[model samples]
Target: MIEIRRSDERGHANHGWLDSYHSFSFADYYDPEHMHFGPLRVINEDRIAGGQGFGTHGHRDMEIVTYVLDGALAHRDSMGNGSTIRHGDVQRMSAGTGVMHSEFNASEHEPVHLLQIWVLPQRAGDQPGYEEKRFDDADKRGRLRIVASPDGRDGSVTIHSDASIYAALIDGAEQAALPLQAGRRAYVHVARGALTVNGEALAAGDAAMIVDAAAVTLEQGRDAEVLVFDLGALNG
Candidate 1:
């Protein structure tokens, strides 16, 4: 079964400096019926104007990830981690017990487009951590490149959760596929461009909750960037 969430149906907020779209319940965008799917908690598409950003924020027991789509994002935290995440970069922070962090546009002219994601950790108060990595363009072109995983396999960032995140770039004639087990589920997010998931067409900002499928296919599409989550069950 596949449940589709049209882009326009999501909660949207347009701050002068920060334009955001919430895929699940976030801040004032609460929707009890769309709180979350599997272990994925939040998917916020954010665009921060130059010289602006999020001030120090606190979080606990969540596996947070930031994927920079365009421009650059500067980050700093109480954990003594400070850096700039640019396009093709993936950043992960494990707020096991608690952590404080801030994000800002790294450029003085260009705005930063990014996705801030949250996934429930497997256990509370395990340990605090941070990691960042860059994936080759070839790795994501025409295929899903695993960028985050529970075991940190293949040089990907480690997340304290029983799930994996992959990114793909599909253009004309390029495609990819993922196979799933009986109890697993998937979340597909379209960052930009147009594509088809299995047989359903989706455009930028659209998403799908998939289950009970033996395998899924993503057809290469014009200017399309996609994120896929192979998620495990959450006890809640």
Candidate 2:
């Protein structure tokens, strides 16, 4: 089955310096019907203005992944991990026991656009860890690039959960396909441009949830970037 999360249906928050869209129930946006999906807890599309950012905050027992689409994000955490993430960069932080961190735009003029994802960890209090990698356009063009997985396969960042995240940059009639395991589900998020998933078109900020699906397909309609999540069981 396939369900669409229309861009307009997402929760919107515009604070002058920060404009964000929440795919699922988050912060002050509460929609019981759109609370979450499987083990995928949150998907927030954020655009921070120049010289602005999220203040220091805390999280625990969640697989937090950050995907930068434009500009640069400076990250600092209680674990002493600090870095500047930019376009083509992916960062994963497992807030097992607990972790405090902050992310701010590293640019003085350009806004930082990114997707912040949270996946429920399989085990609690496992241990906190962090990893980041750069996956360029050439790597994702016409294909679904596995940017994060449980084992860090193919050099992708490792997450302590039964989930995998794939990214694709499609254009010029190019396409990609991802085989779905039986009993598993997938979530496709369109970051920019337009594309068709299994023949259904998706625009920027739109998302499609697939469960009991045989496979996920991406066919280019125009230049676009997409993110796919293969997730396991959900809380019952």
Find the candidate with the highest lDDT and give its number.
2
| Cα-based lDDT for every prediction | 0.93, 0.93
Looking at model 2, the pairs that clash are: none
Tell me the TM-score of model 1: 0.98
lDDT of 1 by residue, 73-160 (tens): 9999989999999989999999988899999999888899999999999889877889999997888999989999999998899998
Evaluate model 2: give its lDDT. 0.93
Segments of candidate 2 deviating more than 4 angstroms: none
| Candidate 2 per-residue C-alpha lDDT over 1-236 given as tens digits, one digit per residue, 9 for 90 to 100 | 99988899999999899999999999899999887788888999999999999899999999999999999999999999999999899999999999999999999899999999999888899889999999989999999999999999999999988899999998868989999999999999999999999889899999999989999999965889999999887873
Mark the regions of model 1 whose C-alpha exceeds 4 Å error after superposition: none
lDDT measured at residue 206 in model 2 versus the true structure, 0 to 100: 92
> Would you estimate the TM-scores of all the predictions?
0.98, 0.98
Each prediction's total of clashing residue pairs, residues at least 3 apart in sequence or on different chains, is: 0, 0
